[model samples]
Target chain A: MASDGHPSRGLPRSIRNAGWYLLLSVLSVAVLYPVWMTIVRALSEPFVYINEGQPFLPVAIDWGVFNTAWAEGVMGRSMLLTLGVTAIITIAQLVTSMLAAYAFAYLRFPFKTVLFVLLIATLLLPIEVTLIANIRTIRELDWLNSIQGLSAPFLASAFGIFLLRQGFMGVPSELRDAARLDGFGHIAFLRKVALPVNRPIVGSFVLITALGAWNNYLWPRAAVTEQRWETIQVALRSISVSRPERFNVGVAAAIIASVPILVLLIVFQKQIIRGLTAGAVKG
Target chain B: MSLSASAPIQAPTRRRRSSRVREALLGYSLLAPAFIVLGVFGYYPLYRLVHFALYRPNRFGNGEVYVGPSNISSVLADEEFLDGLWISVKYLLYTVPTGLVIGMLLALLSHRRLRGIKVFQAIFSSTVATSVAVASVVFFGLVNPKIGKFGDVSFISLAKADSALRGVALTSIWQNVGLTFVIVLAGLQAVPDAVIEAARVDGFGPLRRLFRVTLPLISPTLLFLIVILMIFGFQSFAPMEILTHGGPAGATETLVFKIFQRRAPGQISEGSVMALGLFGLTFVVTLLQLTILNKRVHYGE
Candidate 1:
């Protein structure tokens, strides 16, 4: 124990033990309010229900309105587009990061120290710093309104490389040498050894990257101006901005926008937190 | 703990020239694909921003007019940039402490040995699902002037010029408090049970145990949260753009938002300069954090 364990010198234990439970229950309601309302209004009829009974409650649920919102907002197309783009970015970044990390951890090269230092230093460079020039570059390539534009700038990440490198380097060199003696090439070793051992890191990084892509607001909005190429984030913004009258539809769009990632978070909360904090705690 | 073992002892492989060449080749090849992508996006864009900031590119991406570093000075003097900086500071003030305090409160409240405690923890952390855009839109709907949930339609803070920032603050806090909660919960969990029990044995009261023991023990995580929250807060833009479009006036525009929201065509250089300034700000803040908080943050045995 690092600290003195003396509980009796604090506030009355009886009051704390009794009151905390009630305080937590009440606090839960406050925290859940916006999310609950979003789902409720998303399910309710758009224009008519706002004017009618139980103004805030989710009674008179209507799937028809959500269906109409999906069609009208082109949310289905945009959602699919976002999903495909997210998947590509996630998978590509992982493969690329894995390769780069393996090199850093196991292979020898000239200026290896300099290269690693530079890459790590780049972690401090915020994406916003380069957004201006990058968007212009995207424009010059005629990549706007395309998956290439959406996925290109993010196909590699310093953060990903740094993370995978930490995990790969943590692996025992003895195990690696033994594998090589048994005729495992780098590719085979990575697939069988590195990937398998660091599955938590890989899994968590996938979730984080997927979340980033799904929630992309600025780049997607700025890069792809065409309505056809718009992601759901852009679509949701335009929907809410254009048709506050269609409030329920707007809420439905937001809900539909968030569901997949929400499921991922619920299922992989531990790994996601691990992935997020990996750089923070140790780096 | 496993980190101590990573000092590479070169395997007893052949050290001949051919083998060395092959090893180097393989290393570079592995690094090549990612380096190419990073070159195009990360390093290349950073280089271009510096170049762009030094010169004014014409309407076409082809020609350039060199204006030198005066562009940065001009941007610094500009009112919008200064206003954006102020807004950024205000956002940090509102969202950062509130999120930390609320999160710690949630953590402490649930750190009990109760039944189904995880259910409450999960609910508390559930807002992590709402992305910036999604959360901003949700808050927008909630506080919309008419048909809005909270304030009377006419008195909606989001619709007013002076109070729109506060409205955005609520959205930011709602989205971020979950993250703080999770981080703090992890920190609290890491505190050794023996420490708590020892405090009880020493006649430490409930609040004393918390103040003199648990909070101090968990301060490292809290400090870590502060660094992240400061960075995240300074970089906030999506809520401003999504919720208020940077205002009922320009009331909610923060530094990152200012970097992208151009009022004129030649403002790319200006925005680039501001972006770099924001980067400098981020680096300085991080340095400040490490120097200031390093003394107090506990590294447990």
Candidate 2:
């Protein structure tokens, strides 16, 4: 509204608004156009699609291709396996990060500052840097082709600890003292007071972690040798590579793999955005 | 009564000392799980990575023979390694600036107080839902040169060796645009309204105000986005793997993809060296960014 009254602008307000709307609408369409085409490609018959010069809309719709992709790609099994791995990693991250954050926030300890710095320093050593050695470690542990290997390396996250610690620090010290006076121990105080107050942060962390685990690509490809253990991402790749003729089947598989996360994005849109921009934006 | 009164002072001191020790133990116990996981997975692998780079597996296949820094030296001298590094840098150049400009434009366009603007915001950020793998596949189909929407046109050939990296970069830019938009918009939203109003009152035109006032105000966010986009660009693997498979002449083989391809047992030592090289490059870039840009960034405080 403050910008609406600017004196330098020559265009009228209504006309300016209309221009903005038009530009935004065109951009939105450009962004969504590829995705819409993918859906059309997936549903249309290959022969009909090509004959029709790949029409913008599906002609001679074929819903059975989804079933074929689901079966051929083994998407159902991969989806379940991915969901399980995601659960393991997300829950472990939340638990370990909460404990670490609580200790950092409220508990007294030796080497507190040193440990915190060390933990944060791991941020520099991203998984990409350690990919080779980690694969070796997983092999040594005999965790290859196992869910444990897939999820083990990501069980704890330095970023999660830092974020949760920030959230926990926002809990007033007076409340902690009050909780202590009421015979609440460390765990009880965390459960009753700290966690409830930081629910939004926790929720954001959950969605972010789950999204990362579910969409993990490189590690899963390296860790699992068996088709049964392949995550949805790895499965999609194999389907695409193995069935070049049935490109639409691969597209169908990609769409299937994306639906769950897209639904999550739409439902928890705010939390996901906040989670992503957590440290980037200052209060 | 005299004994009870005398014990009060001594008992208080002893109890306080014990309670402090108890608190310290509790803290250590609470921190143990995260430390254990990080030590085994995060820190240990780093140590082993260095060790792997310095040693070659013995002929017996049972032990490793220390070869000093030969692996690192050879890896540096290798032409393929250099090509991969160059390609990664080229990718960074291609994706980061384009993504930044586009993301900034989208954020600025949508940062108005108009009716039903939330719908547009949602659409702008919707690309976040697509993972790198999904985006790559979608783009692969769209640019496949045969059945693609733009495949029939002859003016621009995406599947060719010269433009293959550009093709992968296009997919990456699209996938990452949502993240960039979100971060930049958050930064834009944080800019105080009074600052913009003051600029307008000072008779600054729209473009001039954006450059001088708004841009400086959000410089920190922009810098953060640059660092992140650079990292993503360097670490990019899926787009290359899916779209071109490092392409007609290894044009899109980033350092990470090269390292990934060397996962076999014999090549582990060499791969370790390359991985460390990637780490060194990332560290230098991040440090360079902070040192050079820190002076220019304007903190609100």
Candidate 3:
């Protein structure tokens, strides 16, 4: 469908294409405007984002708003807490999902189809539907305002099982048989053979889960009242809402909160997109 | 672990039966942890939803009393709940088409083979990296009329009683546009070349090809995106929670927000009822879209 590379292209077509390009450039700027303004205000003078007279271009820059924001708000601790929670959830989900995925993909069990359907059925049940119920469960377990509350409900991902099962099913049975003949039990085969063979899917799942856990706000908001248990996003929102005077610091906190995932995006661009589109296909 | 019990079960197909039992044992062991977690967090909530919806917690020192299905009507008749549902519909109307059109437009623009197109694509999809909470706060800060561009304009948040929802809806569109863009771009790329070539040979203009041949062929992707976006829009909470906090006088208090706001024992029944109502709405709409759209999608069959 793309036929514009050749020099034989007419001037009319070129001008039209240039028009499209300009529109795209302008729209991109508009799309990036909110983020740009936030980052500029964040790194620039504090509260300049709120002032009526502050220029679009920052006049004076304060590079330490991040430090100040982190120090003042529960941001630093929140970030560390979020990282810890994401790590716990990621590791727990990976292990559990991998095990379950192996069972679904390779093994035959009684009521296997029924169990699989039940798991997939949960995909339709968004957490919003069950937030109250889950909160009650967390309270009952005395896991509220703690790391377990933050990560327990997310320890098993139905999406992970579905994604990895596709990968495992792609594994040729001959290879599995050979590994089995070598006395590689399920765990042994999974680690040495299956995981390596399905590294991309595994990597994608890890990044997606990390991103989800890092960005989770609703559950954390519902389950945790203590500031000690707040994730960075939730903490940032509380700061912005309860204290609008600290808008700049809230922006700073946002910059800090998104930094790790931004780094991840830059590093693992293709894997993130793969994970996203995998979700689209599943939907 | 239960091999001893399995060993005692003699059958005509003894060998096959024994391996079946052993595999079942292994499978159950592997699945137990995930299943337990799912049961507690996933299925249990659904069960509790029905239970919670059927009872009303008394306002006095007394506990919850069985109210049968009355909670459903109470929740449905709640002024905030109804407003919330209305705002959610408005949100879906506002965000979905805007996002879909912007995404489709950008996809068509980027589908052209031009130099430095990847840079433009990256810029278009950059917002995909941001979380809902982050984007909401950024917009929240920027919506101040004093310094920020969006704030300078009165139409953003001060347009009317329902303007807060509009403001939050703008953020949702901004944040979710990248997702729609990426999905639609993939759809465009997957669009077969033969049809486009045939359209070109048939003397169709660029715009005509886009409106007729391309969009029709890519309607499946568009339909999938619409369904997902509808679900996202109906279920949107974090944006409203962070940006509007269910108001400038609760204008943006969508259903999820109402569900969240109703936390007291007196309101928990309504919350559960609203949650169940929303769950049913989302479930039905999703199934409806999938069934309706799947038949009409041009699969190049």
* lDDT against the true structure, each candidate: 0.79, 0.84, 0.79
Residue B9 of model 2, lDDT score: 14
Stretch of 10 with least lDDT, candidate 1 chain B: B1-10
Provide all candidates' interface root-mean-square deviations.
Answer: 4.2, 6.7, 5.3
DockQ of every predicted complex: 0.47, 0.49, 0.50
Shift in Å, residue B262, candidate 1: 2.3
Regions of candidate 1 where Cα sits further than 4 Å from its true position: A1-18, A45-54, A279-283, B1-15, B57-62, B151-156, B263-265, B286-301
True contacts kept of each: 0.51, 0.49, 0.54
Over the stretch A191-211, how does candidate 3's per-residue lDDT look in tens digits? 888899999999989999999
> What is the clash count of model 2?
0
lDDT tens digits by residue: candidate 3, B28-145: 9999999999999989888888887897766674877788877678777878678878888999999999999988887777886777888888888788899989988887766644
Determine which window of 10 residues in candidate 3 chain B has minimal summed lDDT: B1-10
Segments in model 2 whose C-alpha atoms lie over 4 Å from true places: A1-9, A49-53, B1-13, B152-158, B286-298
Selected candidate, larger TM-score, 2 vs 3: 2
The local distance difference test score of model 3 is 0.79
lDDT tens readout by residue for model 2, B1-301: 0111111012246587886687778779989999999998888988988898899899988889999887789887899789889999999999999999989888988887889989999998989999889998888777766566766444324668777787778888999889999999998999889889888879787788888988888888888889889999998888889887887677778899999988777889889889888889878876766554444434543
> Which one wins on lDDT?
2
Give the native contact fraction of candidate 1.
Answer: 0.51
